[model samples]
Target: MPDLVAIASPGRRRQIIIRSAASCSPLGGALARAGILVLPAPPPGRREGSPAGEGTTNMGLQPPQGSCRGGVPWGAWGTVCTALCCADGLVYALGGMGPDTAPQAQVRVYEPRQDCWLSLPSMPTPCYGASTFLHGNKIYVLGGRQGKLPVTAFEAFDLEARTWTRHPSLPSRRAFAGCAMAEGSVFSLGGLQQPGPHNFYSRPHFVNTVETFDLEHGSWTKLPRGLRMRDKRADFVVGALGGHIVAVGGLGNQPCPLGSAEGFSLARRRWEVLPTMPTARCSCSSLQAGPRLFVIGGVAQGPSQAVEALCLRDGV
Candidate 1:
């Protein structure tokens, strides 16, 4: 049986609980204590020596002390940054809001082998909540916000050259959009479209606009009107799976969060409704592993402990 390694937090302490993926039965002892809130997924290709249902030592990801920018606590780097593991197994932290709530242009890379962080060239556009993708040899950063206002900046960082290159900005400004790459194209999905200078008095609203940046063509193209997402959503979990783009729970036009899910088939060129998510929430962290898209902790009334995965139906 395959073992599932679950990262759990009980009280203020973090623990790793390993168990059978099929049974999910507790292996007993102190490791099986209750109040496990969230599950932070291990990087893909990680392996364990223990058999299924055997708990491992209590381990957590903690940056080396005095290793962050200016020797500040790693937690001091405020939330809302783009952190992703590259092909080299190194973690890269890109533009985000600083402790003072100002947008930052800093870029830092963490080497797990050495257990230390090192700085790289700063990004050309300094913003937070940007959509990023690791595509062959470069990391593409798309639309992001500056002090609650969206910017059209699009840039890329060359991993080999260690330099930043400016690309064509987004066709329109959007915040909290979902982005994923498939078949040599970068797809930008639903988000909240804020009002511009011409309509500054208008309220911000959710949009279902869909656009794609063709890497080979070096340009952006908006999908046809009929091909847009069925639901206007923002802060959702999206990923590419089985020749389709799946979008999970997020904030819609309603007072409560949306539980609806849908998938856009690249071959069919239309969005198909999927089963509703078990938990209705927004602002969740997501990670794509093979055919599974894991949506982790988010808000459901308040902070939610729900960790759910949206998988494709059998036989596609």
Candidate 2:
């Protein structure tokens, strides 16, 4: 089962493993058992060899280690459905549902230098189940639930202006969707939808629609079938890697969480199946720290403190 390490890579560890396997090591057998056929290491004084269309790195298989309190502070109550982003060397914890089951518009920023979270101006719309992505000096909040149904409202918070401005709304409303910014565009991926009369899709099924918004053009276009995600997932973690958009661990057609993952190659315009997450959970938070992507804190059987990451590259 130890060999399953390759199969059970959470996020950051998988990235490290993919890059760290530059040369053959004693771990070859275990990796082989995991179904990974590693290429022989490059000769000394030579560049490392990797899969075709892949780049070289110098990372290791070491996993991320550390923990922080889940709760924000005495005055700031903790809640689910939160979104996070980094700007100007600070982390922003965005809107989420409060204990009353009402979506909150509160915005809080964490200062590492001060080791505390401070409040910012509230969002124009109170939302839950929304996904956030940073582009330039602004933070874009995508589709999320306003009440029992999904919301199409799209808005951006300008870091420099300290204000929220309405942006083009989503063509189709969705909640709990996975989102990421790559190549000057914002992608809104799969999530759950409410069934309505006259609609063909029934039972509140998961959506496979993939839409991308051009930041410069201010337009949204749905990706073709060939470019869609391999899996229909909601509440999953998503991040940009090697110019690819990777989706990991979320709810699917099953009752339990999914451990599966996939990545969309910008170069090839195809979805590549990646290793499944070590754990499966919903409503978890994902963030990019430098070249690594992290999934932290969510519900599996119950509240979870588990933290996982993927180094997008070997050296960086």
Candidate 3:
């Protein structure tokens, strides 16, 4: 087992001192005893979007001290749980729920050398709780929620052109789905969705669908059912690590947040479960920095201020 150490946090952040494997089980029982809510995922269609069940407050997370990695200036909109990506020598803050709980299309970029944010062209459709991934010089926005309704619009922003263009919208609507670019194509993984009148599922079900959009052919194809994720999860994190697409902690078919994680191998074409996250939480923010994936700010028991990172070298 990897060693668990307590590192002092900067600023107002508390030191997350998970001392030893003996004390901290893979189920994160230690965290649960410490006032962290590790409840299993509630039933589907119970109130939608949030995994906290109905009437439970959304984990409006604040970045822990030193969790933002390259000293990213606080976003102009003061948002939380937003998609922040670093590419082409700049940090991009895309659509996320503003501090006031409203969807925002605001796009801001931070130039490290200049130490300032420059407003870019806003997304054509404003949304919060959306996820963004970069391919080549463009940023793609996937499904997100707006006022309890899922936004199915799929749009991309060209870095050079500074404009948004609509691509093929998702075949079905979903919110808080996980997306990652691999082998020159973009992959949309599982997420929660409510049943639409015309839908095939006919009932709200946690999904394990895997759809890939080929940039070259400009077409979308759903992988076979056998190729779907082993776990039905949403509000998770997806990134390419060790040459494989890995899905981190999120809410699934349980009453509590899932600690289990998995990675998809193109060669093996199977989702292989990895070690569970030391801290089980949903709605956490994940960012790939160097050889590690930083998982920050999500709800475990309640709104969490804990931060943890999975060193990519472990998988490689």
Query: Which scores greater on TM-score, model 1 or model 3?
Result: 1
Report the C-alpha lDDT of model 1 over 1-316, residue by residue, as the tens digit.
Answer: 1122233332231111121222232322222353332222233222222222334243333344335332222332333454343445555667777656888887876444443456788888888777777777788777878898986888889989999999888887788888888889888998999887798688888999999989888899999989999999998888887778888888989999999999988888789998899999887666555566766666779877676778884347
Using lDDT, rank the candidates from best to worst: 1, 3, 2
Count of residue pairs whose backbone atoms collide, per candidate: 0, 4, 11
lDDT of 2: 0.65
Clashing pairs in 1: none
Candidate 3 local lDDT, 1-316, one digit each (tens):
1122222111211212121122223435444444332222232222222223343233343333223233332344355445555565565667777768888888876554543456788888888767677777787887788876778778988988888999887877776688887798888888887677576666666788898889888888989988888889988877777767888888888999877788888767788877788989877655455566657666777766666777655345
Error of 1 at 76 (Å): 7.9
Candidate 2 or 1, higher lDDT: 1
lDDT of 1: 0.67
- Cα lDDT of model 2 by residue, 1-316, tens digit: 0011122222211211111221224444644565433333222221122222343243222111211233223233244556555555566667877767898888876544443456677888888767776777788888778677787888999988889998888887666787888889888888886665477566677877799999899999988887888888887888888667888888889889888878888877788877677778766655454566766656677766566676665321
Best by TM-score: 1
